[model samples]
Structures are given as C-alpha cells and as structure tokens.
Target chain A: MALKHSVSGFLADRYDMETATGFLRKQAGKRLPPHTSWLHVFGSLSLLLFISQTITGIMLLIYYRPTPDEAHKSIQYITAEVNYGWLYRQIHAWGATLMILAVVLHMTRTYFFGAYKKPRELTWVSGVLIFIVTITFGFTGYLLPWNQIAFWATTVGTESANKIPIIGEWLRYFIRGGDVVTGETLSRFFVVHVIILPWALTGLIAVHLFLMRATNLATLEPVGEEKPIEPKHGIPFFPVHVCKESIVAVLLLAVLVTLSVLAPWEIGEPADPLVTPEHIKPEWYFLPSYQLLKYFEGPYGAFFGIVACSVPFLLLFLWPFLDRGKHRHPKKRPIAVGIGLVGLIGALVLGYLGHVSETEQTFFGTRYHIDHYGVPHRVADKSRDEGE
Target chain B: MSNRFLGNTEMNEPTPQPTRRSFLDWVIGLFSAVTVGAMTIPALAYFWPAAKGGKGGDVEVKEAANLKPGESAIVQLQGKAAIVRRDASGLVAYSAVCTHLGCLVKWDGARKEFLCPCHAAVFDASGRVVSGPAPAPLPAYKVKEVSGKVFVSTT
Candidate 1:
C-alpha cells in the first residue's frame, strides 16, 4: 500500500535530490508510448456513460413502481411531478443505445487491431459479455415502462421463448409471471433490470480493470518487419492519461446532458391485462431475433434462433483460440476482420428487417433487393398478397 | 486527435502507469461468470417468495332489529365466502363458520362477540380483532333496505 518503491533508500543515498528527480522523470517518460493520442477517448467515454446510467437509474427507481397495476402510473408521476424526472428517464433510455454503440465501436477497434490475441482473450470475451448484458439490459428495462409498446414487445419475447423446444413453456411462464404479463411480471423485470444486471456488470468491470493491470495494453503489432520502435506509443497512466480521461468524460457528460434536456421522457397507456396490444415488437436489440423468427418455421427456425444466439457466445469464448495467428495488424488478418464486419452488417440488416412490416413470409425470408431497382416485378404482388 | 493516425493512442490518459498491463483480458473472464450470476440471482429470488394476492376488500352488514340497547354486531371478513350480523345497536359482519381450523363462531347473545370457541378468535360487532390469532378478520358483506324488507348483499 505504501507509495514508496522497494529500493528508495538506496537510490536516495546514491544520487543528489535534483539528479534523482531527473532520473525518475526520465524513466517515467520512457514508460509511455509517444503515440498515446486522444482517439483512446472512447473507452473513457463509455465508462462515463455507464456512470450516468447508474445515477439516473437510481433516481428513476425512487418514483417508478414495478408492479403492473402501478408501473405505468409511477412513470407518469415521475414525468409529471418530479422535475427533470422525465429528462432522467429519456437520458437512461437513449443513453443506453449510445452506450451499446460506443461499446461496439470499441470492440471493432480492438478487433481490427487484433486486441483479442494471447494474454488478451479474456478482455475481448469480457467485452463481448458486456455487450450481451448491455442488450439484455435494454430488453428487460424496456418492459418496465408498462407502455403499450413495451407490453406488446415483451409479449413477442414471451411468445418467442415459448417457441423453444423443451423448457419453453416454463421459461415463458416464469418471465410473464404465471403465463400472463401481470403485476408479477412487472415486478420480476424490475428486479432484473435494476438489481441483477447492474450487479453483474459491476463485477465484470472490476475484473476488466484487474486484468488490464496484469497484461500490458496490446499495441499494434509491427507492420511488415517494421517493428514498433521501443518506448511504445503510450503515456504513463497517472497525470497524462488520467487528465485526458477526465476531459473525455466531461465532453461525454455534456453530450448526454444536452440530449436529455432536448428530448423529455414520456409514458404510454397504463397496462390493462384485458387489452391486447396491436404491435408486438421487442427491444431494438431483439429486432434481429424477432426478424429471424419470421424466416424459420417449426424446428429449423428454432435451430437458426439457437445458432444466432450461440454465435456471440462462440465468438466470445473461442476468439482467443480462433484468431490465434501471430499477425496483430488488422489488414494482415483480413479474414478475421472481414468475418467480424460481415457479422456486424448481417446483424444490422436483420435488425432493420425486424422493424419493417413483414406482411408475407417466404423461405427467402422478407423482401430482398434484386439489385434493388426500386421494387422487384413480383414484389408488388407479394406485398398485396401479404396485405390480404 | 483525428483518424489520420491508427491504433491505441491515448485519447485521454487514464492514469499514470505504474506498470504497463491491460485490464481487458480479466474483464473477459469475469463477464462469463457474471452473466450466469446476473441471471441466476433474480431467478432464484422469484421462486423463493410466494405469489401476491389481489385487492378487493371486505364489507359491513347491520341487523334489522335486535330489540336490545347498547349492544354491537360481530362481523366477519375474508373467510368462507362473506357474512355479517347485527347486535342490539351497531352492525357486525362475519362468516357463520369459524376460521381457526375450520370450526364455527357462535354469536354470544349474552356477551355480544362472535366467539370462536375452538381457537378463540374473539370478534366485536365489527368482526375486528377483539382477541386471538385469526391472521385476518372474517370476510364480511353489505346490507341495504328495500321498500319493506332489509336485504344483505351475500357472496
């Protein structure tokens, strides 16, 4: 715990005070890489966003009731009575989206730079779990508002869960609290969103920091025999990097605050167990799954769902082993980078398809472009049939 | 500052480096266990507690004419459907049967309390706790008067 080094007494006697200060200063400078620039701000920005979520989440919990009978009412009270409560909710919602985006970008940067290699597989996979939890956080939190949209969206979730082979019924039964989205379901989701997920994320973050303390930051691998010059491109973690992180945090907070101010929050109709909502869509993240649900039928569709779910886990668990090639320069490992990019693009496309109305289902899935010349010749007929 | 340079350049220096280690790998390992834990904690808590009940409360019923003075009715609420009664002056509502171990509450015309002799969950005219462990008061119903007849709301 002492700040003093083990050999402090020996060094102090050997060198004059000024010379010793100079010697320590030289060593500290050598420890940092010169390329330590501002682009690294994203990670700090992410940390700051999460802190915002924690604060806003706690504040919202003070007013937002979790029971189905009262959840919607509590949200309304917060929006109308608690000054800035509306803003806080909006910030939490949209800030979550932004956090996911930031995380993805961070991961992409790491992947492209080959940050998931030896001694770093743990970090990469942890990041992947965080991604999964972040999305889950969005889903579980979505239904707490008790809006018609949230209610129906979660209905889709329950229905989807029911489609799973063995324990589907039990799973859906538990999630909806006795086969229906009632007060019990609302309370269950509240406990998950507020208490459970955050606790998990906090532990992951701690291990994430601990691991960083153990393994050196993965620098860009030497490009084509041009090895990274010594005294790599980084600064000491103390004043230089900490100062920058704090500034980045401030800027991120500024942006989030501005967005929260501009877009106030709102709650929809109080959930009535008797009324069935018209639109049944899950959270934005689940859009891909919801979209996939349309493409597969019976068992095959179920298998595809399983595959989609497993891919993230597979990549997270086996990434260190999968991309074990020595080349850390992204351009050199085009296959891995391309694979990651393709997966991302597919996810985005699927998410988009999930939101767009799917009137008709086909083996080819929803409508796709034949070079996308406005519309395909048979497309109008297909859509017409779907409408009918 | 811009995209001109690539790779892990410090956009914002996090802190002074005592050592040059990256924390990411540890985070990855931690994520797997934490994910499982996050899911399990809420789920275990769910099955532990019993399910909650609905709202709808109890009601009251008065007597037509007890032909006595200064006496009260012993009412029942939340047991064996719904029932009520009336003493000399005030109204009391209770189930004709008793709650404790399913005995019966005998209306004591002498003392004016619905006395469950089996468990002794004694109740006053209101069927409220005059004594003993009846987790709740007896289920009660309402009373109203017609043109010539006084009718009680049953069930």
Candidate 2:
C-alpha cells in the first residue's frame, strides 16, 4: 500500500490524474434510466463476442497461411497439431455467428424500444454501418478456411457484383483481384479480413459508443422527450447495470463454450476450383439474401437482384429520418410494428427456403425434391409406379 | 541594434504581398498532392490483378498413344482445370470450369458428356450445355498433337 501510494503520488504530482480518474468514476457511477431492462445486454454481449474474436483471430494468425496452396493445409495444421488451436478456432467460428446474432438482436431491441430517434439518429446510423462492417468481417473471414464451400460460395457471392451495369465486371475483377477467385483473392481477403476490417470495426464501435454516451439511452418516453436522471432515484450504472451485463456475458460465454465443444467446426476438403461441392451454401446469416437472389432470372435479373438485396440496408440506414414520429411505444406505431413483423417473418421464411434449397425432403408420405430456386417437386412413388 | 532591426523590418515590409502567401500555400498543396499520389498510385496499382499468374505455355497432358479412345483426362492448364478427351476423331480439350458457377466439370465416359456435380449442369462432348442451370457451355481450349505427345494451350 505504501509503495502503491508513493507511485501514484509521484504520478499525481506530474500529471492531472485526479481529474482523469474522477471522470471515469463519474461515468461508472452515472445513473441509468429507470426503464433499463435485461434486453439491453445484447449490445454489450456483441462487444464481448468481438473481443473474443479478436483474441482468437490473433491466435489463428500464428499458423494461418493466406496462400491458396497452403491455406487449407494451415487450417488442418492448426486444428490437428497446434496446442489448443482447435479451441481457439472453434470459438472464433462460433463467436462470429453469435456476434452477428447479438448485433441483430440488439438492433431489434433498439428498434422496438424506438431508441433510434432524434438525438439517437447518428447512433442508429453508426450502429447500422457497424452491422454492415460485421457482415463484411464474416464474408471475408469465411474464405480464410479455403474449403470447397468457401471457394464456391465466394464465387457465387462475388459474381452478384457482375450485374452492376458499367462497373459490374470491374467490381467483380477488383474483388477477386482477378477474373476468378485465386491465390490473389485469398491474399486480398486475408489482408482485408485480418487488418482492414478489424481497424474499421474498432473505429466504428468507438464512434458508436461515443454517440451512445453523448445521447444517452433512449427511454420509452416519446421521441424528443427527455427524463432527467436523478442519481438516487435511477439505477446506478456501475453496480446495477454492470451486474446485469456480467450475468448476460457469463451466459453468452457458456453458450459459446458449449457450442465450441459439442459441435466443433470441421475443416472440409481443400478448395479445388475445378470441382464444386454439391450443396454449396453460405453461412446462415446470408441465406435470406442468397435465396432472394435466386428468384430473379433472365436479362434484368442481376440488376434487380442487386437492388433487392440493397433495399433493406438502405431503409435501415435511413429509418430514423423516414419514421419521424413522436411516439416511442410500439403500441402507438401500428404501421411500423406491422412492417417490422413482415420483414422479420419474410427473412425467416427466406432463410428456411435457402437452407432447404437443392435438397430432397419427405413431407408426410411423399418425397419431394427442392430445386435450385427452392421450389419443391413431388417425386413419383417408385413402389406404386413399378407395381402399376 | 534596435535601430538596425527596425530599419531591416521597414525595408522587408513592402505592400502586403498576398500573392507570396498564396504561392506558398500552393507550393505546400502541390507537395501534399505529390506525396499522396506517390503512395496512392502504387497502392491502387497493387490491387490490379497481375498480368501473369500461372505459367502460360502449353501444358503436356500425356502421350497421345497412351490415352485410349472413349477416355478422358483432367489436367491443370495455366493453374486452371482443363478436360482433355480422346475420341475416334482426335483429341479435344476444354476448360473444365462450369459456366453456371465456376465449378469444375467431370468427364462422364458412360454419359459421353462433361458433368458438373454442383447443380447437375451437363455439357455435351462438344462443350455445349446439354441440361441443368448452366447458362453457357464449357469453354474450349486448343489441343495440339506433337509427334506422340498431346499438349493443351492454356494461354
């Protein structure tokens, strides 16, 4: 204690430690709105997942080779040979899915609570951009595994850019760093996934947090309304809100650990550009868009498909400006609630279709084959047909 | 010393030359632009796909005499998959990449066609799309028979 005091005193004499420390103390002890709920924990949970990803990603980089020839080999080496590498890899893989889930859930909660209003508009905009960055993180990271699914999925994913009129072809080439996905593409994705995205996300998250702090959490009160938080009356951020967040974090970690252990991610066959896997589907988060794109066909299909995929993001980014209403409660906003429900249901249905596309399934007594466009056709009953 | 300093200052102070300040600003701006361009140009160029990536000469598949009629061989040409088939007419070579989604196609001797396992896209012996979701046929490559050996041009 004496040594600690002396060191602190020495530093205090040289620097304005008192004010800096006091500011942090004040922030910690700040009173949160009385209406703060457990649902508010998702944003912090998303941050926790990002931290986990960063740690595991660094661990992975130790052994990961970005070259096409060695990328798969390196993954195999990490999974099979490196000490606790499998654990890190599994956590990183599972963390990405959970991070996206947490971000979506957080956004959903914010939307329902009508938090993205007036002072919180910039917060919502930053959050949406962060979501986009998070998705790019997933897309770029997916290819690092260098598996057949990654290869073909990337091929399909990048090919969507080919519909963009004048810039379409160049965009595809730029993305791939070539006419097709190759070693160059792997290198580009590696640099992007590892370096570019991490910095981008970190910067965006800082902006988002700064805005959140500046604006304060939106309450159930109407838009543009303010409730002065009384320190004694409101919940203290340090102990009360922190405790709730800790509990959620612990639960989320447990889920992540359980997932990592039980169903560890598999290192599939090395990417062979020549041979494509039979069922090449992207990660579940992209399924909705993937399935949506399949509905468009013919000369104008690509252009329209690009537009259709972009509509949701565009709407989401500008939602605050579009919905300039005073009411914060969903009960007061019937149309907004209805539209949200429709979008949610539509995405869920589309994701299901994407998952079940190009597969054979049995419904009741009949076997049906789901085709490329996710349309099901009844297969002839072999036994009955043969007997007849 | 004060008198001389004042005299020097008076001599230096001409009509406030706004052009000098503007010229200095322009110089700084030009220098900044040059510095940025020096970095930006190389960075932008770095992203462009290299002119040469895999070896671009003829890739020898095998001896022409060894590959029997009704048989096919899958080989790497210019680091891309290419299919070579031997028939009674001669040897024919085509890019193995499927037009539907860039999956490699397999030669099915039984079906006398190139079959893409993904999406079940099929291409006939002549590299024309036979069925399935493939919008275009497999691209054909030039095949040359030199003495007893067969070579596929991957340029």
At residue B35, give the lDDT of candidate 1: 97
Best by TM-score: 2
List, residue by residue over B1-155, the lDDT tens digit for candidate 1. Answer: 22122224466865433222334444555898899999999999757435433233433333433414444333333222233444554443445443322334666667767766433457766666676534346566565545434444545
Candidate 1 fraction of reference contacts recovered: 0.00
lDDT of model 1 at residue B26? 45
For residues A1-388, write the lDDT of model 2, one tens digit per residue. 9999999999999999989999899889888888898989999999999999999999999999999889999999998999998888999999999999999999999888888988899999999999999999999999999998899899888877877889988898899988788888898899999999999999999999999988778777896567788777788888999999999989988998899999999899999876767778889999999888767654576578779999999999999999998888889989888888898899999999999988899999789999877899998888999999
User: TM-score of model 1 relative to the true fold?
Assistant: 0.60
**Candidates' DockQ values?**
0.01, 0.33
lDDT of 2 at A347: 92
DockQ-based CAPRI category assigned to the predicted complex of candidate 1: incorrect
